[model samples]
Target: MYRINPPGVYAHESAMTEPRLRARVERVAAALAPPRVPVVFTDEQLPELIWEGRWTEGLKPMGTLPEVRDPVLVFSTFRFDGKEAERGAWFDQLGTGIGGHLRNALVGGGAFHWFPAGLKEDPYRKEKVCRACWRLHFQVGCLHRCAYCGYGGVLVTMVNVEEYIEHLDRLIERHPWQLTYLLEDDADVLCLEPELGCLGPIIEYFGTLKDRYLIIHTKSANVEWMLPLKHNGNTILVWSLSGPEQSRTLEPKTGTLEERVEAARLCQEAGYTVRYKFKPILPITGWREDGARAVATALTRTRPDVISLCTFMWMECAEMVRRVGRDRFDPHFLAAAEAAADTIGGLRTAPFPEDARAEMYEHYLTEIRRWNETVPVSLSTESPSMWRRFEDRLGMNAANYVCGCGPQSTPWLRQLPCSAWQGVERNDQGLRGTW
Candidate 1:
């Protein structure tokens, strides 16, 4: 409930008095009123352990369970003067989710990127092969306790929202071909909510832009904060959903299946484009039934513009078992993964054979079609061969498919290619011929 800015912070005193800064700070504090959890502020990016310890101390009263721990929001106000020295510091502060080499590559440049699948010589190229899309990060770390993810325990957010918006405008103007900027693969940004108070401003900023759109990717159900914003149908909300069993066991401290779909329905009704991503779909016992029910819940409840599918594909089989526990996985999949462990060549992820993954994708595709056959369905982070296997059935290929968060995957580009739409401009009347 209280703002915790350490004394003699790196941010100048004038910044505290600046109308925009003060308004953002005060607004977030006010939103988190009747105080339950304390907000910590620091100019320096502290170690992850330090932030975790602070979060534990602040949320001690909430309970000892990881699910009950609402992370202590650390407002990092380290000023970036656009200098080389400070720029290095800025990228360094971008949490563990963004890697060191990637941080170096983004210096003095736009954070929006379509990451390559590495060079032919790269050893991990096979595992890394997937459709590329432009992604951006507003916050770095997460607050949720999903077993597959490492970004948890504390949420460190850069407080220069105005500065970021200004810079983002330039990035959008430069990349006229880019349609949507995914905000955030790193964190479940909305889980910080109205208390964070940054998303509203960012959403509105995208609303003012012409053809540019923002995709808010999250597993959190804290979307009431966005219901009132006039998104101008330029903002898309893609929920990283999972089956009921997986949500209950694997993804702790995140929204329930019903909660996420209901939130999607609300967002759709609010005139924002809504989408879903069954990411890392666990191949547990009764997975087919469970995944089908989840797809049904989403499709019947809310009309998603697109649905992207992804089988569980993170870390090696043994590593996942070690991290999430052996009992958490289905015995059949576990046995298959264990048997195939030594055969893993590229990235040790998705230990299942090609046929197993194809089965999973095909089952979900059938369930999706039962409700809405015409709705665009695509694969997420899948290899070229896998995409080719089902490309005919999906009516989408790796290159031209509408994705959960691709740069050119907006509703306007649903049926048209990016090249076809590029020649047209977005004016008061909208895109020439398309609109």
Candidate 2:
């Protein structure tokens, strides 16, 4: 970790009551290089910019600047009425803003709400195929500059974390069937840590729960601060992994593969269940050898309870060409995607054909099984047909399979039977009435 400042140094005294919590916030703030222009908001404007997709209007206030010379940290003071226990400062600052331009933003909103991921239909297949669960966002926006990713530039940190946890607790209580809460679908949350200081309390809060679990998804290796938390084995630390070439060329800003694996091992040793997600698996040149080697290396250090695999799915064939350049993808897959680009339209499925995706998944499965035969592996956000195709090979189907962040996939209940959803209805977490 970058030790920029001494421990527990606060630029300005915050109204946060708890000493330990305040200390954590101060520690994170101290680590960062102070922002040049510290802007604060006290209304729905920032939220609207993030959630309502009104960045053009939002950026109008910042003036027409080609690039940000000094890093800017925006803090939200709204809804923070004079209560000491409910005070915080929301800011976004990574390193110095060198050659950084505000091109686009993918800020996770400041609202505490449930997204019906299972209820959402795939754009390509036009059907509900994902596992039934709720997608929770603690904070929005990522700072990592992955070449293939366009979800950076602005990070919206929910300052009032106590209230966010309360809202989450109520949501979890209302939906008894929703056993797992998957976070970080929209952000690499840990990247904001020490500075954010909310993850620790949230993990401890989940520790007090019964069957409920918290799945924190990230591409960050910022786990030293979390190793001593009272997670009680309720928090599942999931790392979004990539092969050597992908990590090097594609995700240069994020942690290296070895760093992430070592972080997972540390978390696993600290009694937190660890999971690996080969999300957006790029089929670059020599991918099989590199991917298999990455998997073998990870397995050698830590034994993840479950593993999930997903092919590269963000950009279109032409979009990939535009964003990451045409040279990023494998020639074969790129040619096939280009041939089928017209038919695919604006759908968000993987760029490859069904057969190609299956081949990648099959190879990953074989690699995983070579190390651990019984570690529950499943596809992440894949279609029904693809799941069915590999149902036998995966040892579980989409109906009752244990994913990296499914509601019923508590660490204790490792392998749920196919009939696990016997009486419980497959209803969305946001729709409690249907169940």
Candidate 3:
């Protein structure tokens, strides 16, 4: 019922006072009438909308990473009401289900899968479902068409926002404190905010509960819209980020790296707790230099409450590369990325040769740990057993440390071993816990 205009769309009274500008406003307003109900836009309709446009001109040329072999065509089907809509694609297993499918179909599959597995099986709670922290594409369809993304045909259909709200209301009534109503959906809250305005309402509704935390993760730089909303400590905003190089090369349409940092800084300034996710850390030729520089830049620019660093893995992303064609970019980089994951104990178990994977993991762990000692680091979708093996080597419990929010009470405290912490402190000069 309320109309919230997007920024940079309105005119000043000086212009409005002119008959011509006034008439134009009236015509534009009439043309821009709100739909009777929010309409779901499918992937078919997305291309026509200018918001889905992408720019990828200034990216670096693909380097020599090993090419993906034996690409697997995966179909991620979300079933509701016994009806199914299918999205399928070939991947080399380096991305999430939604992202992989989108890449295979849209961007021609040169990108790697970034989605982590076992998120649906939260190891912490046997009865609880451990959905991945980032669920942007699955829930909302693909909103932003980043240039590297291959999901051009992916459609984001809008479900009835009120209906979903009611569903949550009913669920809460039936099972009090049973659900951690975390909005880990792939669609960012900012993207949905303009349409549903659900944040304030959801917060208000959930505020009545005695137990529950609403986690909203995003990479969007749209912060002004969120500042005015009312939220209690029950909500946490997890932001995914990368260094300037990665941003420039890989993340084409998302907000600039500096803008994302500014957004995180603004959220912290607004008294809202925020978490940092530096996941799928790609291994370029100078990965150590690049990754360390990224972390240092982020640390200096925005002091988030918690930071989580992850190494890159490519189990489900191989198919994407095959679909996109090797000639588009150097397949060697992808192969090398796979090699790096294999070396790092984070490779997927079953069917994969254990001896080769173990050897790769050994080398990968040694390097990543050597660089980032303080921040709590963990693997996603890695077999619990394999993680345990590396956890022993790293001197931490990987099973319990699934989500990279750091520790529960003192999340800001880097969970490195005391010796390693001291080493990091000495090297990361001038770095402090507080902003």
- The lDDT leader among the candidates is 1
Tens digits of lDDT, candidate 1, 304-353 = 88888988776577666765677666787788877777776245356776
Give the worst 10-residue stretch by lDDT in candidate 2: 97-106
Error of 3 at 130 (Å): 6.3
- Candidate 3 residue-wise lDDT at 188: 50
- Cand. 3 TM to true fold: 0.55
For model 1, the superposed segments whose C-alpha errors exceed 4 Å read: 1-19, 26-72, 84-114, 117-134, 345-349, 415-435
Candidate 3, residue 403: the lDDT equals 45
Which pairs clash inside model 1? 1-37
Higher lDDT: candidate 1 or 2?
1
TM-score, every prediction: 0.80, 0.78, 0.55
TM-score of 2: 0.78
Highest TM-score: which candidate? Answer: 1
